[model samples]
Target: MHLREVRSNQFKLLLIALLIILCMALAYRLLIVRKNLKIAQQADELQEQKSHLLEQQMALDSLSRQLKVAQQDNQEELRQKQSEYNQKAQEVELLKQQYIQQRQYLLRESTIYKKIQKSVSTPNPDHKELLTDKDWKAIYKCIDTMYPSLSERLVLAGITPTEKKYCYLSFFQLDSKLEAFLLNVNIDTPYKNRTRIRQKLKITGSEEKLYEHLALWG
Candidate 1:
């Protein structure tokens, strides 16, 4: 009986030892599982951060592209404006050239311009007029009062007048200047030149001209 009781006690001890070992192994497995789960959660969080970074990079690239495109568009607009300005400047230059050419042509084609170019001394002096001494006195008085400065500058040419219904007179210095001021005279586009041409006068020289006036003999 004693031997049998000893064996029973030994068996109980062995069972307790087995149960402790089993509990230790189960706790170790639980700790390993918890560690693995924590590692997985950390890895997931890292992946999410990497994805966010990638999205930001893409957005930045898109914005950069947009800015580059905008710069190109602005440069194109500036080029267009420059082209338009250049074209307009060229047109204005062309128009100015045309106007100058036209004005020069018209001046060359004028009859007075031809006469000024070809005139010589004593341009057709034997012209006739109808005037009395009273008319001459009246003209002298007008010249003195209306053009006092001119009277001081120019000498009046002497003219012989009679009741013979025709007379001729010559002018002294700056003769043609008086033609524009003559109002009470009838000229048939034929009158004696008061001064000679080609005496450093006419357009090619000092811009002087020879004009004639014809009065009806009454």
Candidate 2:
């Protein structure tokens, strides 16, 4: 009976050892499965992150392309505007030059007209003798009939009873191919006074030449 009881205790210890080994094996298998699941979750998260980064990169590249295109378009527009402005400026400058030339031409014409009017308005010495209005009018009529346009100029030069004895009359032909005649009158007087008068009448062009001719006669 003692040997049987000892055998029974030995059997109990073997069963306990078997149970411990089975528990160890099950725990190891469960840890390996949990580790594998964790690894799979990490891989999925990394893939999602990579996909998001790729989308962002694509969006940035598209925006960059658009910005470059906008810059190029702006540059082209600026160049066109600059070219147009230059053309307009050149045209304006040309117009300014033309305007200046026209103004100068008008000024010269005005000056010539003034000189002619001054010559015509001078008083005639001969008209002083014809004090009566009717007589003066008749003399003016005669002068107009003889010289037409230059009648007033001729009367103003020296046409009076006092001047009749000293004044000589002549006509001048101009070289401008116009059918115009200049009436010339000379005052012959004391030689010294005549020289003074001649010097005063020394003008330009045909008028000067005529004055010199009259002086020679004096």
Q: lDDT tens string, model 1, 1-218? A: 99999999999999999999999999999988886576456445534544454465565555555555555678776565555555555655565455434433433443333333343232434332223366556444422322233332222322222211122222211233333123123442123332232221221433433211211000
Per-model TM values vs. the true structure = 0.31, 0.32
Model 2, residue pairs in steric clash: 126-159, 126-160
Q: Kindly give the stretch of ten consecutive residues in candidate 2 with the minimal lDDT sum.
A: 173-182
Candidate 2 residue 133 C-alpha distance from true site, Å: 99
TM-score of candidate 1 versus the correct structure, residues matched by position: 0.31
Best by TM-score: 2
RMSD of each: 52.8, 54.4
Superposed by TM-score, candidate 1 places the C-alpha of residue 147 at a distance from the truth, in angstroms, of: 99
